[model samples]
Target: MIAFDAFRDGETARRLAAAIAAEAQPGRSYAFMEFCGGHTHAICRYAIAEMLPANLRMVHGPGCPVCVLPVGRVDAAIAIAERTGVTLCSFGDVLRIPGSHRRSLLSAKAAGADVRVVYSPLDALALAQALPDRQVVFFAVGFETTTPPTAAVLARARHLGIGNFSVFCNHVLTPPAIAAVLGEAADRPVLDGILGPAHVAAVTGADAFAGFARDARMPVVIAGFEPLDLLQAILMLVRQANSGAARVEIQFSRGVTAAGNRAAQALTAEVFEPRAHFAWRGLGQLAESGLRPRPGFAAWNAETRFEIGDPPPEPRTACRCAEILRGLAQPADCPLFGSACTPESPHGACMVSSEGACAAEWSYGRGRRRIWKELR
Candidate 1:
């Protein structure tokens, strides 16, 4: 096992940063997008972007699950919460994300909807068991890392014959989102390499990024959240760019492997299947990128149990969250980032979650002067 403290050592981070700055070409730009919100948080929190060489740019991807979830989905969850005698449980991050007309589940709760913040699906399950008369719905939203646990809860609920408990599944896949970014980069900035999602890689494995590497010809490094890990991953990407080599490498081997956790994969497969198309806040619709309960677990599906109806017209254009999610714009570029949309009163989803790029920048990156300018 890799020493956790070793990844946090200042000297190690300095060494990696020096190596990166030394290897980075003079005029040639190296743009790498870290495709995980946790990594984004770490980079901003530690000022990793400021430490990087000018040639290497760190662009945030739509890795924040709450940030990427379209307003329509949030509206659907709100609809469930608004139902009489029904309880809606969601992760705290989703509570503040605004839906159509700037409504949120938490706001719905304030207006008399029964919404509760939960740490896990198990908590929702316990709520379900405790209040058998109430219809309990768990608003499950995340990448693969959190899907397995949601699956476990669904399986347990089914096994225990808990009729009132169901999940409003919004689980998304990572690789497909990466593909969506690369495949639709005609009008957007082309990425040189990717620092892949570390936690998602734990469940999906290193090889899961092979297809992206092969197709996009970009190096993918599954990196840990530590400052050292981010620095090392950037160094690795810079080296690959310098050498014109593209492949998927696992820098967070302490948590991820080539094959990943087999049992978790099996459990996920048994419980969930991909949706034909799913609406992402920024990317719009992408094929086979979302998950839903399998036929056997249909009884535990909230979408089928309740007709939440179609989402209202897309959220207003004042929020530039869609552009931020697609890497076309930075958080600072957003007009409402600090003025109209502080974390206390978020104008968009990106400010609602700490993992969101806008939130990370506001929390840690605001005071720092702009160190590197993108040459493109």
Candidate 2:
């Protein structure tokens, strides 16, 4: 097994910090978007920004799948569960996210809905096999990194002739979301570079970002979810920006490659296809951004099997989750963040998700807001 202690070593982090400060130009600012919730959490938990040069900034992106999952989808899952002899299963985080009128799966369960939390899609399939009577729907959600496993479980369920297992596929494409974010940069402050997600790059490969980097004229560095990895990637971004290099680079070479796992990609393609349009919480409807069970797998599709309700009414809360996901605002920027949107009482999807930027900052870097104010 690979030793991970080196990646978390404090001395190495300080050395990397020194290198970043030395190389980052003092005359101009370098603002790069880290397009992964894991990286955002790492940055906050380690106080990486406090150790970096004053000229550098790490903008959070909508990388948390749970946070990006639109409220309507959660409403659909609740609707499915409320049906007689039907059970809805999802990852723990997805269950906590409030749907229409802030009604969560946990609340639905308390109100006699058969909504359960499963660690993996396979567990949902197993539950269906064991029950044999109740219809089981796995509310699938996440980026490319998670799609493959869901696909594998579906394939297994099909092979075993399990009739009760189905899935409500909410798997989204990262490239489209990334494109949407970059497109928004025209109106907002232009980002100098992009720190691509490690797990996403592992599935899509570093080459997946090559075209975007060349066309968008921004350096994209695939970073590992470690403070040292982010620090080193930040240094790489600084150098590329200084040299005027717009290209894709991989900082997490151990797990990621120019061409990622071919078997996983093939399996995923076999099980699912793209939806013409999918609504993201903050990003609105993105074309070909969401995934659905393929026609061949319609027998195991919950959306096709059940009658979902109308889309949830437009959220009208004090929450600024949309702004936070769009990189236009931070957690502390919202009035409800600490006062009303704590983890125990999440007023928004961002606070409900463990991978959300708002949750990361609230848990690890709330003091940064004060520091930022003092600096300003």
Candidate 3:
């Protein structure tokens, strides 16, 4: 395991803040987006925003797989669970995301649907094996980091000839989503750099960011989840910007390598294939953004087993989640923020998932009244 303590000191954070403050160009802002919901949570939980220079700002991207899953998909999963012989399985975070008519998996479970929460795909697979007569559909949702494990489970199921096991693949790719953000309209703030997700890098490798760096001319830093790791990454980006250097840099070297985990990547390639297009709640349809089960394992695909179709009707109007995911607006800028959208009753995905930017803001009270009083 990587040593996480090196980046966990007050001195490191202060030094990084000073470096960033010194390099911030006058009248020019450095907008860096961290594409992982884990990073968003760390930023808010540690109040990293307040520690940065006024010219340096962090934008949240579509990092939370559960949050970005369209309402229609949730409804489809609910439908599967409601089937007489089907048992739907997913992470706990996905249970609360509202679908059409404000229905969610949690609510469906209360209505007698067999919706189960599993920490790993293997757990769901085992459950299917234990009950040979019942159909177990694992809701596989996540980025590259979570894909390989799911793939491994699928491979195992195939080897054992587990006929009742299937996967509702909602795995998404990171590169396409990054491209979508960079390709946003000119009116939006042009990002100067990106703090790439550390865990995702561990699976896809740090080298995957090179294409994005070259194409967008934006410095990409694979950052760790800890407070110090993020600060160091910010400082590194500031230095690169001040010196007019843009490239892919890895700050979380302890956990990430250039080649990444080859075994995991190979497993994912064998079990999952990229979809033509996938619907991201706020980013819309992105090419190759989602994954589907390979033909060799078609029998384990939930889409083929059920009549799932396109996404459901969008939530009510006035939800600024789309703008928020694109970095065009902040959570506070939304009309429903804190009023209609709280942790208890979230009007949008960003407020529902723990890694969501809006959820983090509310959880940590960043830029809220309490923090304002403390600063004053």
Candidate 4:
């Protein structure tokens, strides 16, 4: 494992904080959205907003893989899991997410569905190899960071001549979601710049965001996950917003680059193609935002393997998760935030994952305000 302590240094964070304070425009609020759930967690965990000038704001976007997955998809996974002769394998993060009627894979497991949480796609592949008679489906859900692994597993299944192994691909692209946010800004809070996702950039490359930056006229700085990394990225964003210049910058030079991981990109391209449309939790149906198995991998696609029915859209409850995911609302602004939706009982998708904005705010920022008021 790499030693990341140098990037998380206190002096460096303070220095970046001071630089941001100096660069920020007085009396003008700068709203910069970080399009990664990991970034959101780092920001909230480190109280990055409290350290920043009041005029500067960090808007959370729908970058959390678990948080952005639509209820319908989760429902479909549950349906598959409950079927006879089918073994459903998925990442641990996805198992707890509630579907229609508040049903989760965990609950389905309790009711005797062969739902198993896996750490890696290889583990799911192994399960399929072990159970020759059973149809094993891996519930693959994530952004670009996790897609290549799914692709590799798919390729491996094909190479091994595994007929019973298949994947329920829910991998999504990041650029279209960014466009959706910028396009819908007229009715919502406008974003000045973006703090791009760390892992996504490592796979898709920093150059992938260049066109979006040009189109939206928004600065996107891809930063590492550390606190200091976030502070520096914020400083860069503040400087760009003040200058009215928009460009793509890479701050996480250690992991991400202009070209990114080409081999991984090639593997994903070979295995998957963009779906016509896919439903996101908050952003709704985004065109070419999702991926499905290619024609060569048709037999390995669970969508084609099984017959699933579409359920009507459920009524929007008091949960403001959709608004929060779009950066239009904060966790504190939601009526169900603390009262109806604590970390113990998350009422919406945002509260489900540790990286989620609501979970971060609730876990780190909840008692912080009262303490700050006391100190003041």
State each model's CA lDDT, in order. 0.88, 0.87, 0.86, 0.88
Residue 163 alpha-carbon offset, candidate 4, angstroms: 1.5
Model 4 TM-score is 0.95
Q: lDDT per residue, candidate 4, 85-196, as tens digits? A: 9999998869888787778898899999999999999999999989999999999999999999999999999988999999998999999988888885567668889999
Residue-wise C-alpha lDDT for candidate 3, range 65-88, written one tens digit per residue: 877888889889988989998888
Residue runs of model 4 more than 4 Å from their true location after superposition: 1-3, 309-311, 367-376
| Each prediction's TM-score versus the true structure | 0.95, 0.96, 0.95, 0.95
Least lDDT summed over 10 consecutive residues: which range in candidate 4? 366-375
For candidate 1, list the clashing residue pairs, or say none: none
lDDT tens digits by residue: candidate 1, 186-269: 677678999998888888888999997888789888898998888988988888888898999888878899999899999999
Off by over 4 Å in 3: 1-3, 312-316, 370-376
- State the displacement of the C-alpha of residue 218, model 3, in Å, after optimal TM-score superposition: 0.7
Measure candidate 3: CA RMSD.
2.3
lDDT of 2 by residue, 257-312 (tens): 99998999999999999988888988888899999889999899888888554365
